[model samples]
Target chain A: MSGVSEHVVIVGAGQGGLQAAMSLRTEGFTGRISLIGEEPGLPYQRPPLSKAYLKTGAADALTLRPAAFFEKHDITLVTGTRVDSIVRDTGHVLLGSKTLGYDHLILATGTRNLRPPIDGLEHALDLRTLEDAKRLRKELDRPRTCAVIGAGFIGLEFAAVARALGHKVTVAEAAQRPMARAVSSPIAARFAEMHLQMGTRLCFGQAVKEVDETGIHLPDGEKIDADLILLAAGVRPNVELAQAAGLPCDNGIVTDAQLQTADPAISALGDCAVFPDPRTGRLVRLESVQAATDHARTIAKRITHGTATPYAAVPWFWSDQSDLKLQIAGLAFPEDDCIECENGSVLRFDGDALTAAETINNPKVHMKARKILALQAPPGRDTLKRAGYDLTLI
Target chain B: MVKVTYIAHDGTETTLDGAEGDSVMATAISAGLDGIVGECGGSMMCATCHCYVDDAWSDRTGPRKDGEDDMLDCAADDVKDTSRLSCQIKLTAELDGLVVHLPSSQL
Candidate 1:
């Protein structure tokens, strides 16, 4: 395949899609690169849809790459066009009645907010795309109370911002703790306390039965009135295109360690792709800039340089709520034992082996934990203690 | 204002006055303290401002939650008992004269 005619067509022009195009050029691939996205404008990051972009209304900052970068890299970016289907037999993609052929197809469609079947959900707003953030920001201009559905990162982040802006915010979560699926219970409890201290009301362990014009109604028949309702419950992977193309689909588009789908010509990455974890060997789908960008780089190496190394980059994520910044170095399961260090760092261990480390506003230790985990033989507790708990010695 | 001391990896100590409600990361960054990048603007999304809180003052710092604990797993250096994300630590009067050691790298 080296030196042969290469034309790469990447679907979904978000962070991962843009990165794949950029990485291809960075790796010296001079072939034609076409990026197709359902959203309008250039590829942008979704992370800021709930943070600074929301507060400052800075949509420009969310751009993954400037429009000039695409021209400079000789990449064609097709925005505001939906890919109707992928014809595997013809090795082409159908975009709104037009068919474009490709040698390799990369799926970076990402995920969409899951809209559960709740009454009066039409009144509920979302915070996923840049436009959505802008709409929500405009809605926030008024002195209105908001009922935020879910206690996940996005929900809590929005709640914090709303409260800081002097708007009354109430968060309802079906789970007992905030971010229960993603973080440990202790962390969730601490976040709950922080939200409470910030004057954001929290309603946990109660499923929302409906969302009316007034507010949200819980399963227990309690109704909380509010002017706005923001749903940040969860996201569903964008796998319909792959599934329609007759490709294997799971919770996300199933990909191997190299991020290639079951079919050799197709590959997937970012929130839409589920690949094996380097540390745990479990299939996981991550919706972070790190994962999407790293996945793009890996795919680029494979396509341009012919490097077949599996995607083994360490996975990390962060979330901001109020003054607190939560940095995570690795993926951890609920079964992982949470050990509290003297300095307030939580070390998650699978038995004696450290699987992940969670740090709050502590970057130094977080970096150390990542390096330590990367080691062939990580220092044991006794060795770590002998060094006065200093990771640099290791 | 609370006084906080940041000890770098090279053993250089820089002292800074932290605002009452300012996070330790923000205080250190505002003080122009070396080794605190604070990427993601203290959102806890990036581990660029990782530090090692002194064991003696651990009680004042409280404990880390699971989300933070999970984030430390990707830090650039070795993990230790004193590991902490500086952004989560607020500079209150109770944390006066707090000290945090810097890591070698954040990459």
Candidate 2:
């Protein structure tokens, strides 16, 4: 604690940034913490935007903290403020005409929705931010027909909500199954069935060619009429700022296992930072609330305790679609093979070693997966099979 | 703001003013209290904000909703008759001074 200066300036006041500020204070760091956010309000949670907020439209409930909490914690929260550049030479960040110095800088810029190259793309809306969600909610108010371009979590979640609200919803996905990139095939198929049962149409392996004011046109010369269109294809990290600042960025702002950039003074986390996975050693970028908050806590400990511990928290993610709550603990790569347990839980393996477990409405297995992955020696395929994939016995 | 008392498992009580609309878990977390994590940020996805409504105040807190009732089974600590995920319990003027005991741990 005595080794550094007084101020810790954080860019991107998303979940990770706010958690970093809180963790710094909780760790007994009496430094001047300045949390800069581009959005014009208190930092709020993003996961609910696609699920509960869409159904309830309670925007205020998403707020992570009240304005009074920041003031009481002595944390300076600058809303609607964008940090233009990082003046590394001066150890400061440029906010237009003004500059703020930092003893250490944390970048949690997060990500933006990936806008695909579809004609009349302007007709589509996003659900990444509060503003985006508000606009999407407005569209849901009318007796509307929705065309969701992606079968990912956001698109599917929105489709489910729309279906629940008695709206005609059609989800067009280029992939074979919903959430295929995140969940295993069987799990994704199960969710696809859930959406289908709820009367949401799913167009699989169909690339949307264009989006007009009326609806979306598939590449197969077929068109679906929709009053509202949502583009939840995917997201790209906001790495331009870090790249402009001369930090190495691959899929995201590349950092070491400890989340430290090439420059020792700077660190990055959340959807924006690609760090080495403690289990697989693969450079991975996670966009979950769990990853963001965990990375923040790890960085805070290193800053406060002055101990250089590598970031190693098990990554977890959750997606709520209709009544099915899908939870996955540990990181699963595209190449990892998946095994369906007797209890219908999908256990992913990077070769023989258990990498991740995907559970449908099974929190116990998901929790056990997290605990197992956090261990020094996680169970291998043999051990898992011997225990009948119960995880508890292992 | 609605007044609420959060009693830690060790019997450490911290009373704070929770906004009229915010949940009991959010209030405890916003105050930087140790017991509740609220990891999912009131999403009800993670049961990290589990707390036991004091028997005296349990009736006022109402019954647990469907999602919350099922999620409590996954709570880090043992579930009780009055146990609830604080995220589901929104603070209201009528429930001012409501007491909820925090579990030993919220994963």
- List candidate 1 segments past 4 Å from native: A1-5, A380-393, B1-107
Specify the CAPRI tier of model 1. Answer: incorrect
lDDT of 2 by residue, A1-394 (tens): 2385489999999999999998898889998999999999899989999998998998776777778889888999999999999989889999999999999999999999898888999999988999999998888888999999999999998999999999999999999888988989989989988999999999999989999999999989999999999999999999999999999999999999888899888999999999998876889899899889989998888788787788888888888888888988888888899889888889988888888899988766777787788888876889888898798676
TM-score for candidate 2 (chain B) = 0.96
Candidate 2 segments exceeding 4 Å error = B1-3, B8-22, B27-35, B45-47, B52-84, B88-97, B103-107
Residue A322, model 1: Cα distance from true site in angstroms: 0.8
DockQ of each: 0.08, 0.32
Worst 10 residues of 1 chain A by lDDT: A60-69
> Candidate 1 chain B TM?
0.95
